[model samples]
Target chain A: MTRDRIGALFFLAVSIAYGLMSLDIRVPPFASEGFTARSLPLALSAAGTLIAFLMLVLPQKDGPGVEPAGRFLAGLGGFDWPRIAGLALNMLAYGFLLTRVGFLVSTILFLIVGYRLLGERRWHVLLLASVPVVVVFWAILTQLLDIFLGSALGRWGQLLAAQFSGGA
Target chain B: MLDGILTGLSTALTPTNLAMVFIGCFAGTFIGMLPGLGPISAIALMIPITYGFDPATGMILMAGVYYGAIFGGSTSSILINAPGVAGTVATSFDGYPMARKGLAGKALAIAAYASFSGGTIAAIFLLIAAPALASVALSFQSPDYFALMVLGLTAVSAFAGRGNFLKAMMMTVVGLMLAMIGSDPVVGMPRLNFGRVDLLDGISFLLLAMATFALSEALMTVLKREKISDAARAATQGRMGSLKLSGAEVKEMAPVVARSSVLGFFIGVLPGAGATIASFLAYGMERNFARGAKKEEFGKGSIRGLAAPETANNAAASGSFVPLLTLGIPGSGTTAVMLGALISYGVDPGPTLFTERPEVFWSVILSMYFGNVILLILNLPLIPYIARLLTLPSNLLVPLVLFFSLIGVYLVSFNNFDIYMMVIVAVVAVMLRLFDYPMAPMILGFILGDLMERNLRRSITLNDGSISFLWERPITLTILVITAVIVALPLVGFFRQRRRLAQAGEGG
Candidate 1:
């Protein structure tokens, strides 16, 4: 169907779920005098449900600011989804690796991969762009700002040293 | 008031704060010159950097960035016919034409002068108007605050332009729903965290801002497969002539700048009506008021045409700060982001701010003057070198932007969960953007959501379960009544248009 229809259905589902969840919020006896914790969320859920329902049922207006109806699937097909998905995956991987490998290594890998995915394939360019930038950024954070960044390798080394000393 | 002004002058004139303004302006300009980025993104990017700064310095820096972004948007409008921000779209109508005539340098100079004058004039207005308004706002109660918040939210959707009212409202509700995620604010008990401890503290405003504005915007550039570097290279080819304006050209633009600045400032004072609307209105007004030949020259590189929007947009940017300072209410998305930043600094911006932190309140206002002078004197001569940054390839630039945005959020809490959550939010934001939904209303809703609920809860508690307080207080009732009118007027127009269309069809 159309994009607006898809949006309506999505919001409708969200509001219903939200309304159900708000019911699970526990209100203490002392705080339940007039307005409880669940009060605003419940109101918002009802409002969201009503608005979404109206959007689904009402005729979509044709004028400025409103795009003409197009098949939702077709509209989605035109986007460079592969590239976007790659970027999203890169971000996810960075997060996973950050604390595991440390900020410097994780960030450098993130930038190099991001550049490669976006069509920068030059080896020298990738190395030059990623390494120096990451080092400078890392130095700024650790040295200048005095923020601590944990290194997984350093932690492993410490653990090994602790085990040997205990055995001795 | 004199003492407050002197305090502001002393604080704003400090070495560190001046450096903040300079850095903020330079960074803002560079980012704003990039297509698809606006002041909202510019300000959002700076929030991480400002986290360590004192409140006054932080605000001064943000204010400078706000002006610089608008000014930088004008630069792209003139050189590349690409209005990086919506506020500068009208500037391209005449600005690009002037560039085409080999007068890029002259056009840049004119824009700088016009922006300077507009910003300076509006800063004066803010200096006079802010404290007076803050004093009056001191008497506001919880019920009145509740009403005012409702008014601000409704006004945003009302001005969401034709045919998008329901969509904007839906976005607002969604934002409100998002705000209720972490815990029950009043009870301090977890509500919607789904048993995840990471979400117990709730979604950070910085994460939300960066995800929606910065990350999503960069991803959108890649999604569209735009050859941004090619476009930038093409725009930077021509000679920038001389940065000089003849006396006749100055005379023609003088009245337009003055008129548009006043109009822009007033419009900017209204919630949801910011720089974009101000610039367009100013352009239209100048076109209508111009005499014969000058009127024909409108949109054909008329000096008045270029000056009107440039002046008005900067003035409007300054004017938007009024509500943020006086009422603790943000009139637009940029200010909404600023409000979140201010709250993170442990400074609640409201009427009491004037009495409690007069230095912060007045310094922010005073710094606008300094920002304007710096933009004109230092930045004007350096435009060509700055414009060269536009030639940076999208492949390199996009990755860096994404890195910065992701890293900025990650730096705050140092949580891996935040990064994953940000990616998810950015994806959702991209989807919503593709559906033609505006992100500003959602941000506005999110920023105002907690405060609105607090005021509402207090009002309800005070009234002993009676909801009549919504109409019982004169100020609160008046505010709500205005909200009703704002919501109704748009619906009324929609219906009338439908009826007219039906009548014509029947006649045919």
Candidate 2:
């Protein structure tokens, strides 16, 4: 009915699923005599399940809770669902676009969108701020550290190669 | 011992190592001064950069960040009444009042000097103590090591924040489960990879650390919209007069600093007791020790009130390294991340580290000395400028941090999938944190899980699969007993609280 109860139920469901999955682990024949792969997992699952069960039975001391089951569904209305969902979608899009669009482009786009969502209204500030951050981080990561940033740069390299070959 | 110190000095005093130390300290201080960043995030964000370095250099850099952040945290506490890190929370008690009284510069100066004194004193202790402790740990067998890990795991429950024992334990279990993913530690067989090639190495420690500390923090910042605009505005308004402590004031605070430094170091050496506890303990002890008008002056900007916690917390930050370096058991989340960094650098930290890699040991220790000097000299004059950074808009800060996290995660594994997985992990971590679940135990559990399992299995094998090996050895038995006591003591407190609540309910 409360957040605590919802958390308990979630943990309980996860423990059960994890316990079931761990049961399918097959120990290799050459493994030495002792605890195998499933040992800690099974133990963890059991401990988690037990704790979750206790959480359900024992009322939390600090807050007001122990309401009806209908309140569990009602609690969704209490949260800032739209904002949270928007943030989640923003992150998902950023991650999805990262490799496709490349580091510099995706990062700048993500920052602009993220800053807006966080209530920064001035478009000029967002545009001015995002470019320097993207450039600086790009220089640091790719040029300084020599980490291979993906996609857009790689595409540029391909185009250069094609043009040089064609010219030859 | 003298030779080791000399050798450490030789290693750490090199120009590159010295530069790394300065960079680490400066970045640590700068980042830790930001609201909601803290020492853990500072350390976590720096790990990717350290991959380019050797083991000793990486460790020296990390060690610099560790204590530098502690020093930096007091700046925010004093200036903005927002403790940049949890350890500095006690500093705000008297610090903000001191600032309100127009003694901001004096309070900042005292805090810097006190921090220097505490850190220097504790480094002296660490120099003597860590090697001796490592020598003692050298004789530890597999079972004893197993018991020690268990003790470390159990001790988390003791300090796992207010009354969430079961939740903390659940988090520990979950962390262990997460650690069990990827390949099997003992047999070299795939266990929980679920047929994904990317999961073969399991989850990257860098990714886990970033997601748990950095990404989750960004999400929470977004949700809360906690702005430092006011603190920033106020920080720029006035002249911070006289960044110097008077002679009499220095003389008065010296003994208090020394006493709290010693008390804080021992507290820091104990597993799971960190800077926050040390600072609060020192503050409380000082309050109790004060008499007459001085006692009443505590909350109203007493110099002793400001000095005690500042000194002790710095000392405790230095002391926390003792367990991590010697026993390979980290008492706090930041040190646990350090342990992960050490492991990533391919230097297994334990008793053998003293003999095998004395350079690593000594360089890190020597770097702390340099780091404290750097902080003392640099922190005073720069306090005004550093305080101004608190005014940086959250919109810019949050996105910048998120960009760092995303790129840092990708750089480590160079895999797009890891970035995707990191996002998922961050979401779960944010939810867990929202529910007041402590992430430290989970991080420690993940860091210690593999070693714990290996030692445990080896011990069992040596004992012919007999579980009694745990209790048969004196050291093992003693450690297990201590672990039992640590775990049980909290449950005792929990029940007592419940009983009190029940009694009050009945009376009402």
Candidate 3:
């Protein structure tokens, strides 16, 4: 019921779920059993879970007697609706525009919206600042040479080629 | 040993290799100097650009960024009392004190020099130790690996814990559990997909890191509503003039440097034991060792105090790599990012890498030494200049970090879906940070989740549901014993303390 304990619980749940999920990881037949890709993390996570469970059982009982700190954390809980909504919208925006608008454009727009949401607010500022950034990033990573930023150029190649042909 | 040094120097002195080290170190320091910035973020941000380099060159850049970031974390701490990341918190203890005493010049010198001592000494240690460790471990079986991980987890709890040792354990355990959500290692069945393709990969460790460390920190700052930039500026008020160490200061620092280097390197060798502990432990050890008139300098601005932790942590930073390069096991969050970087380059870090790929091994080793020198030189003059960057407004710094992180994260997949994921995770990360939940274990969890599950499946399949399987292996038994000791001892101690506290409270 400790807030910090609850915090540990939240992460602990994630560990259990993660460990449980490892049962299904696909490994190439060629991969070795002892030190294969999955083996290292699988062992590591189990240890992580063990460590977390111990945290719950042990008590330092520091400072003044503990009191419920927050409604949600203290178990007087309700959904974190605002955060859930914000996250949902953010995902929706990215999913919708990923291929439709292209990597650079969609990425810039995403960064701007996220910045604005965090209170960046000024469109002129966001545009002036964010655009050059994406361009410089584009120039440094893509134009100069291929650097992996997920695949904006690859996806847009057909559209870009079609335009080039049209212009020629 | 001498031949190794000469060979290392010969390869390191080449124009491209030298330049790469310089670039890596310079980049590392740049990110390190910027408060709230770290190597992982630097790597994630620059991953897009490095993708084009020769794998070794790319690794050099990443290696530079890694060490540089560790070295950089102290700048903000000394320059403004704000720790750039979790690793530098110990550095700030005495660093800020020395700065306030007008001995900032001395403090900067100690940090630069101590960083050098730690980095170079540990690099040497790595050169000597890595080969030995790898050669010995070349024949490990799956059961053995499971045992090793248990050993590493125990070591990690020892290092990552402070006020809440049990909680740290809890955090570690939870981190491990979450890492297990993806496809089963044995048969490839997805356990937590909830029917989403993305879920098949489970949650990405990198995504989790950005969400928890970078994004969460960003959100909490907003919630606090105080302008950190202004406060930071006011706090870091100083000139970065020529940083030099006085003869007396140098003399005092020499022994501290030697001691911390030894201490830092050993601790860093343990997987999951990060620089944070190396520094804190060094600080405690220095205080204990200071028995003379010099003892008074422990907390109130001792250059020795500052030198020890910086050297120790940097050494520890180097030590963390031993496991990574030798065994392919990342010892800390930053190293985890490095592991991801290696993967992106399609390079696996394990015993065979040494024999099969000497260039990758040696070149990276050679680059690290030069990187340390470059960091020292860069940080020496640049500290004051970069200290000014400490004044960035909260609104600006916050936005910039988030922007770059998102860009960095998005570039990871160009899947705006990832960006969206970043934002959502960031918000959750923010909540977690606000509540004082340590983010390191979560990052540790996410990073290790996939592998934990895989090994479990493989082991169970190999053992065929025999409950005695884990206990049967000698290595496994030993590790389990250690884990049992580590886990049990701490829980008992914590409970005793709680009872004592409760009784004392009633008496009072």
Candidate with best DockQ: 1
**Each model's C-alpha lDDT?**
0.89, 0.84, 0.69
lDDT of 3: 0.69
Write the number of the candidate with greater DockQ, choosing between 1 and 3.
1
TM-scores of chain A in all candidate models: 0.84, 0.77, 0.55
Candidate 1: TM-score, chain B only: 0.99
TM-scores for all predictions: 0.97, 0.94, 0.83
TM-score of chain B only, all predictions? 0.99, 0.97, 0.90
TM-score: model 3 vs. ground truth: 0.83
Residue pairs of candidate 2 with colliding backbone atoms: none
> Candidate 2 on B1-508: residue-level lDDT in tens?
7887888899999998999888888888888888778888889998888898998899888888877788788888888888889999999999889888888899899899999999999999999999999999999999998899888877776776665777777777787888888887877788777889999898888899898888888777666667787876686577576787788999889989999999989989888889999999999999999999989999999999999999999899889999898988898888999999999999989888888888888889889989999888886788788778778888778878887887787877767787778778888887787667788888888998888888988898888878898778999999999999988887788789889989999999
DockQ of every predicted complex: 0.75, 0.54, 0.27
lDDT of 3 by residue, B199-310 (tens): 6776666666666666665555555544546645665574444476668878878888889999999988877777888898898898999988779877788887888889
Ranking by TM-score: 1, 2, 3
Better-scoring candidate (lDDT), 1 or 3: 1
Interface RMSD of each: 1.4, 2.0, 6.3
